[model samples]
Target chain A: MDNVSQEDYLTAIYRNLDEAGEIKPNLLASKLEISNAAVTDMLRKLSRDGFVDYQKYKGIKLTGEGELYAKNMLRRHRIWEVFLHQTLGMPWDKVHDEAEKLEHSSSDEIINLLEEFLEYPEVDPHGYPIPDKNGKIKKSKTVVAITELNENDTAKVIRVNDDVKNLLSYVTKIGISLGKEIIVKDKLEYDGSVLMMIDRKEVNISNKIASNIFVEKIK
Target chain B: MDNVSQEDYLTAIYRNLDEAGEIKPNLLASKLEISNAAVTDMLRKLSRDGFVDYQKYKGIKLTGEGELYAKNMLRRHRIWEVFLHQTLGMPWDKVHDEAEKLEHSSSDEIINLLEEFLEYPEVDPHGYPIPDKNGKIKKSKTVVAITELNENDTAKVIRVNDDVKNLLSYVTKIGISLGKEIIVKDKLEYDGSVLMMIDRKEVNISNKIASNIFVEKIK
Candidate 1:
């Protein structure tokens, strides 16, 4: 429909569902940084537009049509993000904000050209799978939190759980990225800090930070 | 001022001046693909805003202040272009359009972050020098046209003179890119086609196409 506002709501719902396995109004409000009332208002609008199934107070989820719409937006967003960070040489943290604006503005002609230019990258800078043109995502659920790894377990960083600006700059400064191998050396119970080896250097990270790091074991 | 529109005009003027060494209204109109009247209108606006110097029936050029603004815009644009193509896997031709939009929208904070993320790229996807954050360009100006090359002369493809959509795809299919080494092997005087070697493969390119390729001799 090219209704940007509606698409944003649908995409937000998709992200919320992906994270929570169910869309909670309060969580939606938090994620979008909008008021709970605003979320409710939008949910009603989305339900009326046939993009969501909303039951007041209980929660909401995307309809089949809504999921399709949301998935497309997500696909565009991630693909653009990959284009920005990988091809454009943008920092991982900076790409999200720029892509947030661009994903909504891209035309099919440009997106198709970009897809070919990037050789149809399957994943974004954060290692999130970029859905194919038809909205088919390569099925994958392999995500390991850094905090759970045993000593000397080697893994490649995959994706981060959040897009908070401060956190992104913090992690990036330490030189960790997708496909960057890290070995867990020790986990301190006292402060939830973990010692890990990254790029041949020992680095200590907090449990809160470790939990946010999604990784895959090195083969 | 971080106005996107102003930044676009400044960047456009800078690019035009760099290539031609002088900016003519008609030339700018052609480069921007706008009408002469539109160019005149914008020139007036830019002059009034202190980004250009215009004189009746004469040429246009960036003043010291305007040069600073234009170079700043260029720095942002080229840096972002590098980020898009290199890190995100975006195709070379596809990145310019996106970078055009983003170079203006980014804040200094984000641009600096991107520069660091990309490890401070020297040239963009198009092989144009990316002005440093302080606005100094690592200078190189050795222009060689495809039409002038003789057999056995080797040069690196620097950039194309145009960004037309069909032309970009066509050139890309022939495997030309900035920094790609090409060697002229034969020139057909009849049809003005040049047979060249790219890496190991032989390619015959039409004269019409060759005229647009901007290259530099391999040192």
Candidate 2:
């Protein structure tokens, strides 16, 4: 049950849960980049292990034990992220992938020690909150995707979907990062791309990319 | 060729090779605590992959590629060990197991960065030499096992066989550690255990334990 694939499934389920705390098997399969049959097979195993609640043709939900496991995995991931970026001076774009592999290998003791070593970082480099030891995630400012803002909406980047492939590198190329201020210059309804002013330069981003970059409204 | 078990086999073969740079499969099985059948199965695969030159009932020898791969793994392992013990403040006894998992997960880039971050450590906390990027192990003072020291020979603990299970913890319990000075008091020819004085106190260590604890003779 504690194998790498199972651990990965738990974290993937936890990350993609909607407001209702449920996710479809199809979505889970897509997120994991596995086949539908494969997802179904794993879901059944997860259910049998008491880590997930699954019914045929229905959404998947993590059990209490499952949620705790997922959050702890997240705790390991984000802490490793902090250690790689803040302590090791690795690039933010590079830290997520490095931390992903490391998170599975590290123990709770290592995570706790890293937390103390990093002065108990509140967030990872991408600005995602770090869950505490007891699976408690500190509540931070509410954030919205850049695409949700209106024209001329001034905001500050607070978080990005670190899970998205190449998203961080693409955003970094556009001079975007945690704490960077952006002004929404225009919203193109035709292609759903947003023209935003970052670092005083105009950059147009796709709706998908804009949606992954979360920001807090400034004014 | 890059799987964890394969990597472990390569490193084990590299570490246990005799003066002629070969290891009997029986010894390898014993070292890994796996079945001889299992070791044979893996050895066949290793030979097929050109990582080893294997024959039925003959000592195993790592090919050039296998040695490079094993040394690279050692580089990852020892660098991680230094980071865990020196930078993260993990206990020396705890670092080996932690580094074992980490060695398989880290990338070459991560290992290089960690080396630079630690200012290029010459050795791990347990005193095993770290292999550099080119698989070069920096030559240092020659060391001999404490078992090899004669009566009245003073020595400074330099390296310990970190692969031996619970050896570090057991030695630590006897007040042994890197840089600790030891004076050989006597050796029992019967059991081959040695009585050594450390910190002005005498402690008798078994031959097996003494053999695992390497030191440079100071007298």
Candidate 3:
């Protein structure tokens, strides 16, 4: 994308789309932390530019062209994250924000070079699948959020939502990482937080945080 | 440094400084390809911010603080150029423009990490020295422009001016590069051009182009 903000908006829309492949303007505003009016203004611009299908007070959907553009942005972002984490030895928790700025700044040529240099990694540091050069995303396993796991259920941590600020650092502080085994110990009805056994130590995470963490069931 | 244009202006001024360590506003404007009035306005802001010493109708010089900041920016630029050229296999001629955008988007930590990843590279692809973290530049041997080489003088290319647009690509096309040895065969007094033998082939370069190519006299 030519403009940083426009690239960001498309990526956000692509990331937050619901099962029907659409997102409401209000949800987008909240995700971007921008005002609803600003979202409306940008939606009009995107519509004019043939990026999104928009109608007054309707859910926003990306046009085919917009989808390709957004997938390319994600490709750039994830490739940079891999390079930052694996090549530069940057913390995985820190790669997201760094990659965000770099995604908009880098060209496709640079990203392609990075992808090859990193040996065509399957996923980013945060465990999100990286879309290929043609915007073809690899199929990933179906996973459930930690909050959905029942007591005594065992699952392996697969992905953490990088969109939530400080979530990865907090997850790291609790001794949780990708591929870590965790067993649900208890579910609090009052606060909606989960108590899970991580590396034999009990760690309590709020339901909001747990819901943002995806895991594959083991038992 | 937070703003891209401010960082660019500082780097441009720092690179184009003459022996007196000062530059005329007009030259800076021409180098940046911006208007004279815009340069004046930004100079005022930079002066007020203590980055540069500025007064109406006088040459401009970097303050100690400005020099440090500019050196850091150059460090970032050079490190990125090395990574793009050496690590990613990007052509040396193309690294300058790519590094220009990446430099402003990167953090100090990222640059330091890159420096380490590249194993403390001393010079960029263009043979420009990379400033250390403390803003200490390594002392370089005295060199002169290719135009300064007398007829029959053999010299080794040390540096090429990366500041000039499309200069590196042109140099590459003409079979010139850092460390390439050239022997001056003739000098034209008419237009001040030089005829030199490069790689067993005679190449004639204009005085304008020759002046931008720095070399160390070997014999």
**Highest-DockQ candidate:** 3
Fnat values, one per model, are: 0.07, 0.71, 0.89
Please give the range of 10 consecutive residues that has the lowest summed lDDT in model 1 chain A. Answer: A104-113
Off by over 4 Å in 1: A1-219, B18-20, B141-143, B161-164, B188-192, B199-202
TM-score of chain A for the candidates in order shown: 0.90, 0.98, 0.97
Q: Residue by residue across A1-219, what tens digits does model 1's lDDT show?
A: 666667777888787684545788887888788799988887888889888888888768788889888888878888778867776577778778777777766655567667887788888887778877777889776888998888889898888854555677789889787778899999998998889998889999999898889998876
Score each candidate by Cα lDDT: 0.79, 0.93, 0.94
DockQ-based CAPRI category assigned to the predicted complex of candidate 1: incorrect
Give iRMSD, candidate 2: 0.8
* Ranking of candidates on DockQ, top first: 3, 2, 1
Error of 1 at A139 (Å): 19
**Top candidate (lDDT):** 3
Put down candidate 3 lDDT per residue, A1-219, tens digits, no spaces: 489888989999999999999999999999999999999999999999999999998899999999999999999999999999998899999999999999988999999999998999999987899999999999999999998999999999999999889999999999989999999999999999999999999999999999999999995
lDDT of 3 by residue, B73-152 (tens): 99999999999999999999899998889999999999999999899999999989999999999988799999899999
Chain B TM-score, one value per candidate, order as shown:
0.85, 0.98, 0.97
TM value for model 1:
0.55
- TM of each candidate vs. truth: 0.55, 0.98, 0.98
Clashes of each: 22, 0, 0
